[model samples]
Target: MRIVSLNAWGGRLHEPLMPYLVNVEADVLCLQEMVRTQGADADWLVYRDHGIELLQRANLFEELKAALPAYDAFFLPVARGDLFEGDRRFDSEFGLATFVRRTYPIIGQAAGFVHGEFSADGYGPHPRSRNAHCIRLFDYERGYPITIAHMHGLRDLEGKGDTPARRHQANALVDLIRQVKHEGDRLVVCGDFNLLPGSETFDILSSLGLADLVTSRGYEDTRTSHYKKQPRFADYMLVTSNVEVITFDPVAEPEVSDHRALLLDLK
Candidate 1:
């Protein structure tokens, strides 16, 4: 089985993102920073926040569903806000999404907020609401269940340091993992965690018997050339000890989004 996790950057680079989604051919795909605009006809929407303007796909969720017809897609919105098409305003949902290939039978699922609850109104402050989604699939070929969960972590304005809210978020993620995974299941957790390498989040996740594949494998950067930030590590993939990792690649080519895609293949 193969799993790919990426922060899609709201599909700002739609040209490459569209083909990447279709060509990656991952059995399971987890995406963060996805945008969905309901009842909009335009293909592009503008998102403006704190003087930062970005162009996003109007409804990327539906686009992915069309591109990968064989996958069962699931989306969990953390907040609802507005996107603009010229002067017209459209309501848009922002969150994470997971797409599983039809061959895998989804037998269990769970979702919960790791930070604040769902914001029905505009996105609040810097550290906005964040949530996680988990799905347990029965892999008949492997003869065992595989549990996969992902989240786009809370982004604090201050920095990506260890904060009280982030610590709470890590614990909440652990609880969510425990809720759906079974004893003999091969577990995988990943996403754009929005954290530093030395953060306590790794320590918290270590309690679950999962190892960080990014840092442990000596990967230094998870950001593409588009991101001009310093700490180029925001994404990670963690798996249980029992998982047979065939190959793990932090894909840096194609520059599909600002973030690099983490691809993992398992036996």
Candidate 2:
């Protein structure tokens, strides 16, 4: 099965991203930094690409649903804030989204904050509320159930180094995994972790018997055309021992978003 993960950069790269989604035949698509607005039409939201040019995506969730009609889409809001479109501000919901093919039998699902509580009134800053979205599905091709979890990790404005809250978030993530994961079930955990390699965050996840495929496979970068920072921050994809990884790629071409899409083929 082919599974893809990306931090959509708020769908700022919607123009190209739309085409990529149309042709990328993925069994499951996990995306972070997606936006959803109630009662908003296709042209309700807009983003500035690389903070230089304005871009608009009617409603990303709706657009994706149209593009991938056979996939079940789930969105869990972690932060509530306002997004500006021209001179107006609209209430926006920002969080993680997971889309699994309908052919897969989803037996269970769960979502909860891994960093902070829900910002019911409005969005907050670093250490702001963040969540992990998980789904357990029966993969008919493999004839076994696999639990997949995705998250958009805590963003620390000050730096990407270790912090107390981040450590707490890591522990919370492991806890979430333990809550829904079943015995002998294969596992996949991924997202834009906002962390560098060898940090305490990865250490915590490693304790759960997960392997960081990106670093272990000798991949050096996952940044896309939108990012222009040092250290070249990137996303990650980690899996358990039982998963037979046929192939993995942090697709650098296409420039779909600021973060490259992580594609994994499993047996």
Q: Pick the candidate with the highest lDDT.
A: 1
* Candidate 1 error regions (>4 Å): none
Residue 71 alpha-carbon offset, candidate 2, angstroms: 0.8
Span of ten consecutive residues with least summed lDDT in model 1: 117-126
Error of 2 at 83 (Å): 1.7
TM-score of 2: 0.93
Model 2: clashing residue pairs? 42-58
Model 2 spans > 4 angstroms off: 41-58
- Score candidate 1 by lDDT: 0.94
Query: What TM-score do all the candidates reach, one by one?
Result: 0.99, 0.93
Error of 2 at 73 (Å): 0.8
Give the CA lDDT, 0 to 100, for residue 255 in model 1: 94
Model 1 clashing residue pairs (backbone): none
Give one digit per residue, the lDDT tens place, for model 2 in 1-267: 888999988788888988897688988999988878776644756643236544545478777877888899887888666666676776778888889999998898788999878886677755678899888889877689999999988888887889998899899998998888898888999999999887898889987789999999998898975788877766999999999999999998899998999999999
